[model samples]
Target: MDYKDYYKVMGVERSATQDEIKRAYRKLARKYHPDVNKEAGSEAKFKELGEAYEVLKDPEKRAAYDQLGSNWRAGQDFQPPPDWGAGFEQRGGMPGNEADFSDFFEALFARSAGGARRAGAGQGGPGAQGMHLRGQDHHAQILIDLEDAYRGATRTLNLRMPEVDAQGHVVTRERTLRVQIPKGVRAGQHIRLAGQGAPGLGEGGAGDLYLEIGFNPHGLYRVEGRDVFIDLPLAPWEAALGAEVNVPTPDGKVALKIPPATGSGRRLRLKGRGIPGATPGDLYVVAQVALPPADTEAARSAYRRLQEDFSSFNPRAALYQGAQS
Candidate 1:
């Protein structure tokens, strides 16, 4: 599956607002509409535009697409992440008068398209034109701590969902469930809970719920895949010379060896210290040197002594040399 960069197709930024996207779509739609322009490939361009707008126009679909990560490049080999749309309700309908779409779009969104068409035709409801349909699967995100991934945890989730009632009118209902988060679950991983979503119409089985895992931003740590990173602040002297420090990890504090002449931005790796799994990721401790405030006479004297000791070293010499060159 080739990745589709809808933002690129629509000539808009990823941060483009809804109005901006609409404006861009309208402009391109007018320019590429086959009826208005008989240029070569105009029909194809117009259909592609419609496909892009079909996804970007809807907020829910746009959000689900965005969660796939912005790191993917246009035309890159793309496989939709597993259960990417698990808890999300699929809304039907395409933006334009097109019936056929690209393989990539169909693979990712065709189920929703079918559901929408059936809904528009009044076929998804119970006894709707004498047709029975299974409930739509629901998708949602759950936030957890990095430590929670290291150790399995049980989480309570509260969700508000809409369903048809006895009178055939849709009603919003709150549902809560206690879910167990398995250990080593990475960000964006899905937890499928069977029969926990919207109720089925008539005798149809209830839909399944999918919970996508997300981690709240940790103040001291940043996670990438399974790896974790922390900025360890050290005194200037401690960084300049060797120092044995105990750094915090998800497991606990561990002794970290700081080599002599270590500078700010130097990263020390602790193997197998990240989220536990078959092959655990390493923990990276980034060094950040801290300087004491020159408020007291003792601090001022210490700084003066250090300045005198390294007076021959010119930190700005490289900048001056570059300027001269």
Candidate 2:
């Protein structure tokens, strides 16, 4: 797909504000309107202008589009990355008719306009006789800990949704839901709660709400997919002579056996310690040997003794020879 530069289409900077985008769209729309311009290709240009404004005028759509990154150039061949819309809360309202939008716009915001025609199909909108429409599905992203993936959890979220008021105009309403986080749900996965989205129009059931999974940055752990990693600090003696230590896992602390002559950056794995599933991921501990400060006389004496003990050894001999080569 060719990447559309909405900002360039509207002759505005990528950092332009909502008001700036609106003004640009209005000016371009008037200049390119088919009724006024009558120039060849004026209709297509007008449609393109509307599409750019459709995304840039709204904060949510604009933010979601911007997350595609700024590296792309206008008309560049592009495909959206996986999890493109993973961390956004999108409601089921279209600013204008969806039929006027391009294929790229539809693909990007498909979830929002999933049931647009049926949302208010029969009762009285444009070109309506009487038809039933399924309610539109809504999507949101929720952040959880690595432990929550190991052990199932329930999370509460507050959302503002659109509702049709007595005057038949849409109004925003705050709604809260306690959602379940399934065990072994990895990052970028989704939890679907049935019948939790916008209510159906006539004789149709409510839409489902999809919660996309995201992980909060952990102070002690780093997660990549289902696997987990943590830096394990070890005393110099513990690394050299080997020791049994209690290591923290997603579940709890477990006894880990350190092999003798272990070096810094050595990785040790605990099988089946990561996210639980049919096939579980392992937990890896990266070794980081820490030395005691040689400030006191006793510590300095011990260090001197160690230096004397290993006087025949040259740690940088290999590096020095390599550099000479």
Candidate 3:
């Protein structure tokens, strides 16, 4: 969707308060209203002003639009991220003349909905008076760790939801809900808690809760797909001659075999040890070779003799062809 700079349209600065926006709109709207001004393109300017005011006047819409930032030029070719504007309801998209806005308004603010015309009925189609369907949709976001996806867990989450009272007033009410954390659920994945949403209108069923997964950064491993990867630091001797090293996993430490001649960045796979699932994922150990400190003359002399003994084994043989005739 194209980004709208309502601030620019209303002729107000980015830092303008709500009162300032209202004042600017009042001044410009009077000059642009076709009925009052009767100038060329007055209608067009009035429509644009109305659109800007419609967005800025509403606190929810204004806050959401402000989060998009001021970097976008007024008319630049724009696109929202895949997840952009997903959670926010497009209030201006309703059907009646109560919101007689254009498609441009709908594109940014709402979605076009059909009235569900069923053929061969006594009535032509379902109208507003027909059957008032659609109980209120419930919205919620739950946070889960990256490891929880691999290993399922149960958690107690504190949920606070804002709801409308019988008189249509906005009120935030709090409640404690214990939710299940299913394995293999990735970040951005939604877990629906059935019938946990707002109560439906009349006799309709309740809405649902959508839980979005999140991960707290792990101390040792970085998760990717079904696999867990960690950098295992090993001594130079362990890398050259192979050794059994203790490595950390989410569960606990385990002895890992480092094969001889294993170079840095060499990966060792522990099959089916990752996040518990019907088909388990593997754990990968990437070798990070560490050298011993050389702070003594004896150590320097021992290294010199070793270098002299195997001096011909220049590892960088492939780098240059002597660069000479």
RMSD of 3: 9.4
So what's the TM-score on candidate 1?
A: 0.63
Better of 1 and 3 by lDDT: 1
User: lDDT of each prediction vs. the true structure?
Assistant: 0.76, 0.78, 0.67
What would the per-residue lDDT of candidate 2 be over residues 204-259, giving only the tens digit for each residue?
Answer: 67777777787877888998878899999999999999999999998999899999
Q: Candidate 1, overall lDDT?
A: 0.76
Give one digit per residue, the lDDT tens place, for model 3 in 1-325: 4556778889988766667778899999999888898888898888888888887766545654665777888766676533433333221223456766655567655633222122212222445344433344444445556667766889887665543345433334567778889877665566777766544444455555565555666778877767789999988789999999898887678889999998889999988877666787788999999876778998888788889989899877766655542
Model 1 ranges with Cα > 4 A deviation:
1-132, 162-172, 201-203, 321-325
In candidate 2, position 81 carries an lDDT of: 62
The C-alpha TM-scores of every prediction are: 0.63, 0.67, 0.57
- Output candidate 1 Cα RMSD: 9.2
